[model samples]
Target chain A: MIRLLAKPVSAVWLLLMLATGLSWWLGLDQGMSSDQQSDYRYISSGLIIIAFIKVRIVIRYFMEVREAPLALKLICDAWLVLVSSAIIYLYCLGPVPVATGG
Target chain B: MTSADCFSAVERKVEIKPHVPGEVGVWVFILGDMLIFGLFFIVFVYYRGLNVELYSHSQATLNQNYGAINTLFLLASSWFVAMAVDDMRNKTVKLAPVFFPLAMLCGLGFGVVKIIEYREKISAGITITSNDFYMYYYIFTGLHFLHVLIGMGVLVFLWRRARFAATQADVRDGAVIEKDMVLIESGASYWHMVDLLWIVLFPLLYLLK
Candidate 1:
């Protein structure tokens, strides 16, 4: 049972690490240019999504939330998904500045 | 019925168990702590998304190589601590001496690398308030470094006790071994939480463009 869980958990982490490496390489190739703002946002969002997915996998599987009681597991899963979605939404909506001078 | 008899009765009824109420209470406290850190992470990413050019420019000031190496160190340490907890659960108390020191070494190594990274950043004229990004960078990683220090201290204390305690016949019995497992598990859980935070922080602060 341990091996069954460990294998996939390690694999997911491996993939996430690889993706991070790739993203870092792309980030370097793109260089520090003002013109690449849009590209950077897109790449960053993608990386965050990948990270969120990996974290969910680890918490649910490796942490054995899957074997936990249904209500407890549901609360954990729901909380993460809700919080992550809200953050992503706010990120997409851009910063809300309070009007002062206007 | 007398005062002396009452005192003896109270002493006899004192609770002793595998789980410490204080330690378990910390786990509950950590939920709120996690929420606060979650908000900081969200805010950091939100601003970074809005001002990608400035943020990436600020990110350039950070050393990705150090960040990457630190991530690897934390990841490996998390695995070692998890294994150590397993060993404790299985009553392999002898292994505690080995794993605890290894885990503490990793924690020390992380602190050294962080100090070097901080020094390099300070020398490069990027103070905490240099920019919005640097502010978040310093606060997040600095708080993490503090936790690492505390965790290392806890590991050392536990390691010393586990080493000497194992030689006791009382500890050889299932009772004390179970208590040791609880302590080890709590420490391992806290270490894992630290590592998990770094995993997210690493990608957000370093790997992202």
Candidate 2:
């Protein structure tokens, strides 16, 4: 099992698992003491960014796009940038920060 | 047996050829599916922006533990599939057969979790019509669950194929393994796509503040 975890794919798995835990913790309500609730918009934005980074890791490592041809790599990266940017853009464009109902 | 040693060992084994990881046709399908889901995410977010309170309130009603657990499930399933593909590529057929079923088991776990989540939501009287957020929640997750179901079938098919390839590996030249890899990689790529979509969907529906 130790040897298996040493393998590149397995190492990537560990990283993904760690990232998931971080995202879960970030999503939880621990840090939102009344004063910090307004800061959640930034936290929310950061969460979206972290989510996309995880997606890219899955694409490159798990899906083996790292060894793929340039064209395929470009297409995948393009999709990532476009979708992530668009979501963040629209998310911030909203009329106000999300109300925490504190 | 250090991590660096293992990394270099696998690195040396896999030739760094710049080719598609699977069948070209499958990628076409995968990319097209991604495009559609991308549009779905954008549309959902646009509408949510129009009414943050409604969406966020309904989102709070969701059991986020289920979503996070399911994300881990799909990530694990993808990892198993990746290991299987790597084993097959290295001609270490012994683990390939085992890894495929392990992956399927993870898929099964995802299905079970999803069903329980749906049941919980329904029992709470939060059907699709409960609100726009629930509407997108049910539809997006339902569609993804369908993909998981199909991916489970694909995993079964790949498991059988991996078992067959393992049995045949000793009798034939390396050419046989190479031939089997195309199909294995194609199926594995599809499975990874399923995982990737949920990676994006999880935060969009469950975690985003």
Model 1 ranges with Cα > 4 A deviation? A1-27, A30-39, A57-72, A94-102, B1-23, B168-172
Instruction: Score residue B12 of candidate 2 by CA lDDT.
Output: 36
TM per candidate comes to: 0.76, 0.93
TM-score of chain A of 2: 0.88
User: Distance (Å) between predicted and true CA of A15, model 1?
Assistant: 6.1
Docking class of 1: incorrect
Worst 10 residues of 2 chain B by lDDT: B8-17
Top TM-score prediction, candidate number = 2
Residue-level lDDT tens digits of model 2 in A45-90:
9889988999899999988899998999999999999999999999
- TM-score result, candidate 2: 0.93
DockQ of candidate 1 against the true complex: 0.19
Question: In model 1 chain A, which range of ten residues has the least summed lDDT?
Answer: A93-102
DockQ of each: 0.19, 0.79
Tens-digit lDDT track of model 2 for B1-209: 99999986665343547779889999999999999999999999899999988998999888888889999999999988998888777764778899899999999999999999999889988899988999999899999999999999999999998888788765554457777787888899999999999989988998877
